[model samples]
Target: MKIKNITTFLLKVPLGDQRFYSSQCAFPERNSLLVRIETDTGICGWGESGQYGPGEPVATFIETVLKPRLIGKNPLDINVLWEDMFTGIRDFGRKTTGIEAMSGIDIALWDIAGKFYDKPVYELLGGAFRKKVLGYATGCYYRGEDVLDYKKSLQNLKDEASGYIDAGFTALKIKVGLLHVKEEMERIAAIREAVGNDIILMVDANHAYNFHTAKRIGKFLEEMNVHFFEEPVVPENIHGYKTLRETLNLAIAAGENEFTRFGYLELLKNECLDIIQPNIGCAGGFTEAKRIEALASAYHVQVIPHCWGSGIALAAALQYCATIAPSPHTAFECAPENSPMIEYDKNVNPLRDSLLTETFNVNDGFVQIPDGPGLGVEINMSVLKKHLTKT
Candidate 1:
């Protein structure tokens, strides 16, 4: 029906040191900025935006600035709502923290539309192309102290990777680019050996290197049969990505840091990457992400969807990936191998686990798609209230 009200919450979730990569050890991550959209018909939709940049001010941006513009708008008119949100702030232009605030509302609107149509969000978007998506374990990071010894790092990787393998994950991603090339190489080699040649191994540097270093690391990864190298260089350097793509034999993946389809167009034109990783909550939700997927498909790019936030972000990404067809070639930058795995965060979050009445389950490396109306997961308001912070 019509929109009734909007609410926003900045929820902070604590993670165990072992739950995330080593670099994030000191910080208690703010994690997710949660949004709730209520419709007149009593249907509610849930969405998330990562609580990055500045602080809780993002919540204020959504409520004071964006919410007033969205009231009484048709939740089903996602395209119109997205355009209104984008154009309303065009003077400020795109790529602002404001876009991140709009992202949460846009996602909630899509979730509402799915509920209105009495179908899962993917079904409303044109039905699912795959039932279950394969997922990769993504929290494996260096666990060494300031000493930075490769021995401890290597053992930590083996021990952590083996846990994921034992948990039935078919693929796992580790953080790289922090240590020397030789040390990074040894770490990857050890994980590959520990998991055997069958399991897929992906590495992300989080934009920690230069073009020369990416090329050097890419060369080594090619020899190791690394599935993909993510954000090898800074995110702004699409040209560096092109050079790395041309120089390296391994597949290149990025785009978690990218905003919308417009940003992705620059990457696609370069033809440097083979997989495109669009974060549903951050990159303009299902509305714009699906559009980006279509653009990537024309160039024959695969979409693995970068998801590193809370459960709402994970569920939203899964809904989009379930419906978008995989390109004949791999996705642009961060595509996984066969079975089309999604990125799953193994970190701690009461919202990720307890917010939903039924938790999403992973078995044998693949996660089944949600079948209920909307995002297919109901929000536990009690849990939300328990975790919500007062302004």
Candidate 2:
């Protein structure tokens, strides 16, 4: 089908006073950019772009910069269109916005392809390795106004950890490096104590440490039997990653900020990570992420997508998780092993949790991949309208 028009809706929903704190900053609100592509045959598809901070700029880029070039082109020529888009922003030389915009468009095209073929997006890739994927909680962030208040923060995290277990998540990722090493250790200790030994506790430092510090913190986590350590060092520091990976036995996870398949290859070639966490939305959508997964597959590295956005993004991530072969050979079986787990963001955000008439919820620690044609992402336009930030 020929492309007719492209539109973007910028959305923002407040998270109230309950701040979601990571190592770098505290976010009191969640923002997203949704891309809609309509075709001549009356088919429509959806994709989400990363404007988690400034939605308007990315939305404007999608319209002013991408629209003219896309109209009347074949919707199926995804690689050709994606290459064309890169040329449009060649002067910028790998800006995250350009890559993020390309990600949205590519994912939408894949959704269109899936609809055209009358199959789920995962089937279009190569049939599902699994029909449902387990999700890990990404909710234990510093909730108090004073983040360094370890006593309160630890109690709040312990409470959140219990909630995750109650909500049916066996695996949970908690934000760290917001306070001193001793306090952070105490926080991890409390959550582990609350959730007990069977539950998986993963720590994400969000690139908050150097080699010495990352090693020290990682050693503490290993003592607590933490599942993995995420982004302990900055993404650009390849040596730092190599050192950390070499130094620690804990599964080293990185790559959410990683841009494309090529960027991922650099990490893979060096064996810099035991698990790679690429956000399907940010790391070049399905097209590039599939390529990233293929590369990871060759290395036997696990790919647990870093999902954090609206329902559109969550839907896209679910589709991806469905297709990925459970690590080792090319199939998924319910074993208590290192397989793909969906990074379900449990932080407060209605834009992701409530925007769709048919919402995604973690049930018994797993989420069933959408069985409908395309990504199976159907949103209540009224809900979209309610959260639409007027530009």
Give the alpha carbon lDDT tens digit for every residue of 76-130 in model 1.
8889988998888777737747777877888888788878888898988898878
In model 2, the Cα lDDT at residue 371 comes to: 84
The weakest ten consecutive residues by lDDT in model 1 span 18-27
After TM-score superposition, what is the CA distance of residue 368 in candidate 1 from its true location, in Å?
Answer: 0.6
TM-score per candidate, chains pooled? 0.93, 0.96
Clashes, model 1: 12
lDDT of 2 by residue, 162-258 (tens): 9989988898999898788888888889989999999988999989988899999999999999888999989898998988889887889999888
Instruction: Please give the lDDT score at residue 97 for candidate 2.
Output: 78
Residue 245 displacement in candidate 1 (angstroms): 0.5
Which clashing pairs does model 2 show? none
